[model samples]
Target: MKSYTIEEINAILKGELIGHTTEKIVGPEELEKAQANHITFIGSSTYAKLWAKSKASAAIVNETLSVEPGDDRALIKVKNADLAMAKILELYNPPKPHFDIDIHPTAVIHASASIGKGCIVGANCYVGKDVVLEKEVVLYPNVCVFDETIIGEATVVWSGTVIRERCIIGSNCIFHTNVSIGADGFGYRPSDDGRGLTKIPQIGNVVIGHYVEIGANSCVDRAKFSATIIGDGCKIDNLVQIAHNSVMGRSCIMAGHSGLAGSVTLGDGVIIGGSASIKDHTTIHSGATVGAGSGVMNNVAAGQTVLGYPAQEAREMLKQWVAMRRLAKK
Candidate 1:
């Protein structure tokens, strides 16, 4: 574990410091468990009492705290305690991998694939024909990118992930383990004899925007016509399924096990909770929030929070829950 002196930390945080400036701060900990060598945080006034009893040698507090004369541990006062904690964590962050050799010898690249400078293609990775991998892109072992796929700069695709043909991946995007991008959408029509289903050919691809992160095993299916789009800064949790022709606006978040059916349109900053299911052709306006396990069948207004099955407004849903509990007393 790395250590920083009280004075050294004060210099880094650039905040007002109180108490002894020589105690060696090793790592961060919660207020209750923090030792003399650990740094703790007080984000609210409610935690002030807890801080007084905490064993931490150093603490980060927000602007609301005042200097206490009796308790004299090293305190760093800042505008936001949370942001300060993030900076402190960066100081102890693990080292990144060094890619001295750009492409591993075991990797297979087709004749027409174009790999940019400083890119790292790991062992057993497959790059298909006419694929374009931009500078500093990293593909971990067993990753596959099909023909004509264009991966932007500094994108990282982890092991066992697949990006199918003609998909466009933007810069600084992360596709975690076993993610499936541009797979065929679930589309079928009844056969001529009405005995079986006929598959609809998914001719379109997926287009991902910059700084997006898709969690492990999540899948974004290809479009039946144009692209199935994931907008910039969107964060998708594990086991999320985005079906054909679904278009999400920037910074939208979909929690674990969430499903968006084909042709769903989500506006900017829409937040879908865990296990929520949106029906086909539904539109969720900007800044709307869908509660966990919700079933959305109709269009949602801007900035609304919908909850429960056959989703209704959150406040109304809570009232219904209260009424149900009252009736259950009988």
Candidate 2:
């Protein structure tokens, strides 16, 4: 086990120490589970109130909170206790899985495919004709890169991911397990004979920017005629669905189970909460936030926050909810 002295830990956090201690802290733990050698964090008043009952020898406290070190306990005061705890956790994080810089014998690579220096193609992986894997790219087992696909440098694709033909993936991106990129859009029309539905041809590709991380089982569909674009720094959570021709700006965050209908446009820094569904052709402007479980039916202006089904302004929805509750009491 790794250990750090009180002074050494304070130096790492750059915090002001209140009361002095000579003991070493073994690791971090929650307030309810901390022991004498463990450290904990008090980020809000709720956690701060529990400090007196905790057995932790030391704690990282928010600078704005009024918490005193009792007896032999020490307090390291910082601007944000949660952020400080993240730094401390990094100190004790375990090593990640290592991949050797070689292609597995079980993997198949087309004669025309280009594999860059230091790339790793794991077992059962497939690289098709005219495919390009840039330097240091790592593809885990069973990943499929179709013909003419371009994967940028240093990108890591996990198991069971599929990049369809002619798709463009940017550098340093992470595609988690079972992710499906460039799948055909769900477009259909009535058949001329009035017997069955006719499928619309989807011939476009998916273009992802750098530093984006998509969670497990997410699907980003190909466009009808152009590219489905995902901007840099966008973080998409697990089980999400992004339809065809949707354009997302930089730093957009989509929580788990959120979905975007066809041709939906989102501006920079937009946040979509879990299970929220945006209507087709709707535009959500910069910094707009959609509440969890909301069904948006119209465009949202920049910096607005919408809530509830058929989502409206948050304040309006709250007012309606209050009135309904009062009416029920009568």
Candidate 3:
């Protein structure tokens, strides 16, 4: 375990130290479990009250907190204690992965593929013909990179993930287990004979921008013609689906089981709550939020929060609920 003196920690967090700057901190721990030599934070009022009794040698707190007189524990006051603690935790971050052999012996790499320095290709991972993997890319077991696909620098793809042909993944992205990028979109036409459905081939690819994180079991389907784009800093939760031709802007977030149908567009910072579903070809403007389990069948304007089936503004939906309750009592 690594250790830092309270003085060093204070310098790192840029916090005002109230007392005993020389106490040693070994690690960060939960408030209930923290003891001497461990650093913790009080990010909420509930936790703030508990701070007086916590066994931790020091705490990260806001400047507004009042330190009781005669308490021996040191206090580091910052503007946002939670954010400060995040930085403090990063100080002891584990080293990035490195291996003696860049490519695992069990991994298959095509001769035509271009792999940059510091790449780690794990067992059973396939690098198809003409694939390009930039520096420090880590492909965990059973990751399959299809032909002509490109993965940018410092990207880590976990086990059982597939990147289909011609897809582009940008730098510092993370694809969790079982993520499927560039899968054929669901498109079909009724057969002339009225007996079967004819498939429409998905001819395009998926473009994942920098700093994207797609959680386990999520899928981004390939566009019918142009690229399906996931903008920079977007976070897609587990079991989410981004359908054909959907374009998401920077920092958009989709919670678990949320889905966007064909041709849907999301502007910057749009948030889709858990189990929300957007109708096909819908446009959700910047900073809009869709409430949990809502079915959005129309466009959501910029900075709006929508809720309920055939989703409406949150306040309107609440008023409807109030009216419904009054009618039920009658």
The lDDT leader among the candidates is: 2
Pairwise TM-score winner, candidates 1 and 2 = 2
Query: Can you give the TM-score per candidate against the true fold?
Result: 0.91, 0.94, 0.91
Q: What is the lDDT of residue 100 in candidate 1?
A: 57
Best by TM-score: 2
- Write candidate 3's Cα lDDT for 1-330 as tens digits: 789998888898888888773558998887789988888887777888887677888888887877641255788889998789889889978775555677889999999999999889988999999999999999988999999999999999999999999999999999999999999999999999999999999999999999999999999999999999999999999999999999999999999999999999999999999999999999999999999999999999999999999899999999999999999999
lDDT for 143 in candidate 3 is 97
Residue 283 deviation, candidate 2, in Å?
0.4
Ranking by TM-score: 2, 3, 1
Question: Lowest-lDDT window of 10 residues in candidate 1?
Answer: 65-74
Give the range where candidate 2 is weakest over 10 consecutive residues by summed lDDT. 92-101
Instruction: Evaluate model 3: give its TM-score.
Output: 0.91
Model 2, range 161-267, lDDT digits (tens) per residue?
A: 99999999999999999999999999999999999999999999999999999999999999998999999999999999999999999999999999999999999
Q: What is the total number of backbone clashes in candidate 3?
A: 0
Flag the better candidate by TM-score, 2 or 3. Answer: 2
RMSD to the hidden true structure, all candidates? 2.3, 1.8, 2.2
